[model samples]
Target: DIQKKKQGTFLPKEARIQPAAFSMAQVAKKPLPKAPAVSIQEEEEEEFKISTGMEPGKTYTGQKLDLDLQDIDLDNVFRLIAEVSNLNIIVSEKVKGKVTMRLKEVPWDQALDLILSTHKLGMIQQGNVVRIAPLKDLLDEEKERKRVKQERLQAKIEAAKRLQEAEIEAQERERKLRPFVTEFITLNYTKAKDFQAQIKDILTKEPKLERVGTAVVDERTNTVTITDYPEKIERIKQYKEKVDKPTPQVLIEARIVKATKNFARELGVQWGAQYAEYDKRGEWAWGVSSATGSGTTPPVTPSSWQSGSFTQGTGRDFFPLSGWMVNLPATLLPTPPGIGLQVGRLVGDLINLDLRLSAAEREGLTKIISRPKVMTLDNVEATIKQGREIPFTQVNPEGNVSVVYKEASLKTTVTPQISPDGRVRLKLDVTDDFPDRSNANPITGNPEIVKRQGTTEVLVRDGETVVIGGVLEETRATAEDGVPWLKDLPGLNWFFERKTRRHDQTELLIFVTPFIVQQD
Candidate 1:
């Protein structure tokens, strides 16, 4: 049993946990990796120092370079050279492309040249620093600078040539014109030597002859020698003919006239009464008259004694009892004025009074007639002058070219005829463009252009006025004297509004006057 108990103790939890702990300690007892004999980074740093031969914070002299780099960047090779020589070398962005070079025991500059030349790069040595640039870019920049210099030199040469040509032209002109000044012309005149003095005096007054030179006339030979330009010499030859001709002058006048008129009317309805009687001559009294008062006889009725005659206080000083038969209240009855009396026969209780005022009114007529205004037509200056002819060019149409004379759009011509008696006639022909609506195209809705031509001819003397046009009629109506909100009411607004209608006749008269201008 004891032997069984010993085997049981070996099968318990402690025996199982002890074997796991022993295996974990055996795994934890493993040995770490061995340390290196010599430091690789230190060896590399030492080799780098030997290869570069450079110290920090010290000026650098170039050292020998031995490099064997393949398919490396150009900037990387430049960095290697900068370390070896301890020199400040900057690479520009333009220094690009890969490099593959092999060199042995060469100077740093020579070694740098081999690496950079393969990639077409060049360095600029500026004091202690070097700058890298592409060789192609430098060559192109130099070529462009030379081209610009050549262009400037060529421009200067052309300017000098132009100046020399102008000087030669002036000298040639002076040489050709020198001979004409000394030439003389002989003239045979029937008049005395006084005629030679007259010719000399005329040439002196002429500015063109005096500008180039002057004239010398000899009375003994009766010969004239004029020192002037060739064009002036031609005018001198024709001086005798021009003096014999007479100059003509004329005077012209033009006048411009305008009229305006106003008319007003009042429309209303009134209820009133009037009476009239027949006279002794069987003729009716002229107009209706109003009844005065109780003691007075009615002015419109005939008297009792005269039978048919109407009398005003004739032998009847006192009012008869018959005159007081129909009494009317003095305060309630209204009397119409004499100016408001109707002219025709009156019959109804409400008589329509037709008022008429003649044009021979003597008072208060200024309101009906417009005030007169004085206007002067001196603002526009005359464009057509006595001796000047002005030419005007017309603009071309949108889609047409006027190459042929017959196919031209319009032609206007003006001709002025002047007489010696101060009578002037203006002949004007105006061709206007009009749309041809009668022959409009049905599909395109386009109308052809038609030319309507008219001619105007008028004759007038100097300082005379001419008038054209008559009265024109126009009507204007406006709703005035009413409240805005009440006038717009649907049906009951007519009482709140009063409309004013004006009939106007306006006459615009154009007065044109022409005056003669004297020239010196």
Candidate 2:
């Protein structure tokens, strides 16, 4: 290993460990890299995600609209950048009344920035997604963004450290050199020595190239390919610095000191904690989702729930909610993998779900039944971009046919459950079978989802009424066609008593969030 040089002693200039001509005056410590004036947290905040309204591959004109909105009211206008020429503005001039405005200009990006900056009151930040809403939403986003300001600061610090390292490395290789060249390349690399020998051989064969350039480095895979050239080089073209080339001997035998507690704490088990912003759909609600359809919407519902057969002591509802609802299989697993032995604590973190303010359905109308967690992202696809070529001998029949079975998946379709986030989420999962649902449609890859659902039918009420063609004969009241039948039962919510279970049994509760039904 290349040991760092150790200091002999702190003495007079003459007693120092250096050439006799060396003096302390030549080295009054270069100010410690400006102690990064930035505070640790502040350093992190500097790592901002950069984006621009200015677009490339576009033509510009003198008549450009610069969208610069500096101050804005939250509940008034919905600003939308629809196109390069038109800005679609949905404005709520009055309560529940909306008017769409399409403002046009040549340089749309300029117009957009100008308008935005002009009305720029502030911005709202959440998670990594920031909502540039008016004062209220912007304030909320800022509160959330700043809530984790400490974290943001730390992230900035780490990013700055990385940048500093990169810049330093870049500056180090700024020596007087020539551009090393390697012409006519081929993969013939072996050991470094052998590679060097090969380079020499190549140079001996072709004299036009320059002195063996710094081994053509591939940082992507920390490996270097020796190159042969005639002259020396200045700086690496795009790559400004030469990677530190450790000797092979050093690599053969290296010692790794055990990581310290502080180090471990810095990069420890990174867990994902799922939680929505500190608010619900009180005035402005939002959510998005999708549901898989099945059984052709119950063949148009030929009949309704008939309790008249109670006299026969047999049928009425198929099986409570099971006949219809069927415990809508989650976007993921059915019972959500239990949180005990069988499930990994990190698994649920990947696709976390929660419903802080439960779904509200007041009237009998089914539309208010389940307000879905909006803007759902479902992966229903599998694709093999690289196809394997099947090699075969001449003797086999049907052997030459390369079987390329395309990936198929369940077409999990979702409706456009609009929300402030502008993503689709809420889903009405209509199905028939309880346990074995979605059928054997092996959802292998990205399944094609239908958004505007018009297939499923919501059967409210339908019954058989036998009548003599337009002749209305007086029928007995409270009787089912001369057959005595029990009266329709009133609906009720029967409470199922709860019972405690042993610690061994699972008790993981899932939170289903209503992330869709929000204010526009």
Candidate 3:
């Protein structure tokens, strides 16, 4: 019994209650399982560092990437947008561990044979870091955060990439401008001859002149003058911007001669900016100013006589156009800006004027609208009776009244006619889609014009009205006073568009047939 109690610990209680076949020795004699080697992960936990923010060395506390992994690759656009992350990696168990240089910002879940990318690993939350990889690689992370975090990361990355690209483009432009510094110089000259003389004067006066700065000034009187020597001048940067090609419009070559104010006169308003020159009396000259040039706005280029024209505004084909006016050239010339869209608009006023569609062009359009083949003709008539007989009135048996077939009289209309004095008469048009005989029907442009040829279905897209002449002329009551029920009378705007189908052809015929009224 004591032995049984000791064995009870080794054997399950239920098993002990039952009759057992093997003893403890037999059970011990069975081989023990070789304990499998377990790779202790504790040491690996320490090697990883947490980072966040712009700091380079810090490790993210924890992160998760949420990406709606599309089937297509974003083509490495990840770097162009994300800003926070510094390093990213792409991993593959295939190729016996091959890797590509993972530039940051890989998209999530693109089609790749077998490759995974990670922005952060090592037991971090990963919410802040944004990286992109294939859909299959999503499980590769040691840990993952929620989806909202991934979107934020992606947006940041895109913004960063855009800024970086802009910087690079700017740098390239500066490189190009480096050589032009020696060759290009700004000088204010009134005439071509004067400019040449000014350059010669510059050669004699300035010593070791690597670069020169010039500005245009106006005389106290309304003439333009040039100031050759500038005390302190800002560099004229040549930046590359995408500009659409120019289209033709009215061209004007004018200067701001008469400004509204003395202060505006002093600033040398630029011709292409959003400023006005008001005189001391509060009167003003509109358009652009040249005294201070663009001021806070962008620049307006000065025009040359030959290449002087520039495109103005947008989609504006003519001058003296809406919200714009004309200014004569050789007025008060503002400082020469190379040219701008505004200046182009100003120039357009003088040279091109406004070129609206000419009379000939308008007439040409009129001829087309009134041409034959465009306006098809059809025959319309009344069918009160067979063989063209008049309709008559009749009373039905139920004490009800009705119009007999002979009671109705039909008025006739022919095609447009010209008088006998050199006037050509137009006969009633019998319209047919195909050259065929007209059935005894008096409808215009039958929808089932080819019904004889066997057409089963027709789809009505739109419908219109063709008024009968006599029905349109008659009014039930005075239209002037519109007394009480007079406006509600049947014939006033009460007519219906009539359509009937032929028995044999099933052709649809529409007519402006007449209807009678009931009197009190």
Candidate 4:
């Protein structure tokens, strides 16, 4: 068994001894120490380095060793190493184990490390003295050292934080004792009363000025009076400068257009041929005498009629003797001065006949444009209107007639917000009102009111126009004035009737444009 020693024995510095060989006879003379029973718990793997007492980057130049030993006392191996290296060695009582190693021409330090590793041992060197111990004890000692170092570092950081807070508190106390200075700040673009509460809130939140600082506004002079330390007053002034600048303005231009289109066609053919038979006296007579019978003809005449054929021979003008005849043009005649085609034909020779035809057509277009422009500050609303008010008569239950006026006008309301990048956002409400006299109230004789409204929001670039349209109205009508059965006839309808066809269309379109107004 290895004996416990009070102090580590040192070899003389000049005595660099090396044993040629180690035999079992020499090793067996000393009884091997019993291996300590170590219980190692599972832990997270960590990287650690032992202090070897050697300066950084230094190489070991000790003598090489060749050894073949079995069941050798571990403590005795360390003593042999200390003699060869001429260094003091201390071995822990817990470092008790038997080492069996075969090392060939290895450095003395490496031989010691191999034997220590085979027996689960570790070492730390101080100068030329080396101490050996169980690996588990060495690891526990290293962990405790790191933990203590961390605790000390944390304590130092906390102390520094407390010292800094104390310094801040002291500064705050000193600032609270300073004299208060009252300063007046005159605002150019913004009102002083608008910022009074905001400034007071800022000062009240500050630790040093919470109790003493005050902000008051004088509306007449447009100035804010601040009672605080000089530095704090300057800070408040800087903050005011940021938010009290000028607000931008936007000009909104809107155009409302109402277009009306009307188309009408009046086709009428008023054609008639009259037949009269004359007696030998050569005077016109309304009666036609046939060999079988004769009678007075009815006064009403057909719109399209033909009778008494006229024969135009060479240099000979012949009138009808047995039948009524008249000459009628095949094509449409030229229109008359007023409205429709008027054709009148007369054939002479004891026969008086007249033919008249009429036709008319018309087309018209009308456009009414209203331009309204309004300017307002950013995020403000503006309105423009142009129109009249109509009065309506109302009778209450007491039979009293009272007149109430209602607005019939074109109105536009817009709210514009100016973006930082020179774009405009618009909220629009447009209304158009008019009186419809075609459908009047029967009891009151008051015209009906027609209203058109639209509301929308849009984003547009500056100086750009946007158009909105979809209000449309259309009407179609046809009228006929003739005998009911005759007007519907296929081939002869045009000659027997007057037909009128009308088409009307109306549309409303709005164009909006925005311009950023630059202030001087």
Residues 1-520, model 2: lDDT tens digits: 1222224212222121221232334322222121113365763455443223333554545334323222333333332232222223332232232222233333544544444444543332223233343444445545667778868689999999999999865654542143445542222223333343434333323223322344554544434454433332122211213222321110000011122112211221111111111113444321111122321111111111111111122232212222222122112222321111010011122122111111111221111112222233222111111112222223236555333333222122223233343332223221111122223225332222211111121111111100000000122223132212222323321122222333221111111222222222
Error of 3 at 102 (Å): 62
Candidates in order have lDDT scores of: 0.40, 0.27, 0.26, 0.58
lDDT of 1 at 444: 45
- TM for every model, in the order presented, reads 0.23, 0.14, 0.13, 0.50
Query: Could you give candidate 3's per-residue lDDT for residues 369-392 as a string of tens digits?
Result: 110111111222211211132333
lDDT of 1 at 72: 64
Which of candidates 3 and 4 is the stronger one according to TM-score? 4
Q: How much is the lDDT of residue 137 in candidate 1?
A: 67
| lDDT (tens digit, per residue) of candidate 4 on 1-520 | 3333223443233222334474323433443343333233212233346643333564656667776656667776787676566667779998777766766666787677667666777776655656688778888988896897688789999999999999998988877666788988998888888878667756644643555678888999999898877788888888888988888988887655554421110111112232232323433222211111223322222121212322222221112233323222122112110111112111221111111111111122324356778888898888867789989989999999999999998776788888666767777676667777667899998888877565655555677554444344456789879877887899998878987999866544455677899988
Q: What is the lDDT of residue 90 in candidate 2?
A: 30
Off by over 4 Å in 1: 1-178, 182-257, 261-416, 428-455, 470-481, 518-520
> lDDT: which candidate is best?
4
Question: What is the full ranking by lDDT, best candidate first?
Answer: 4, 1, 2, 3
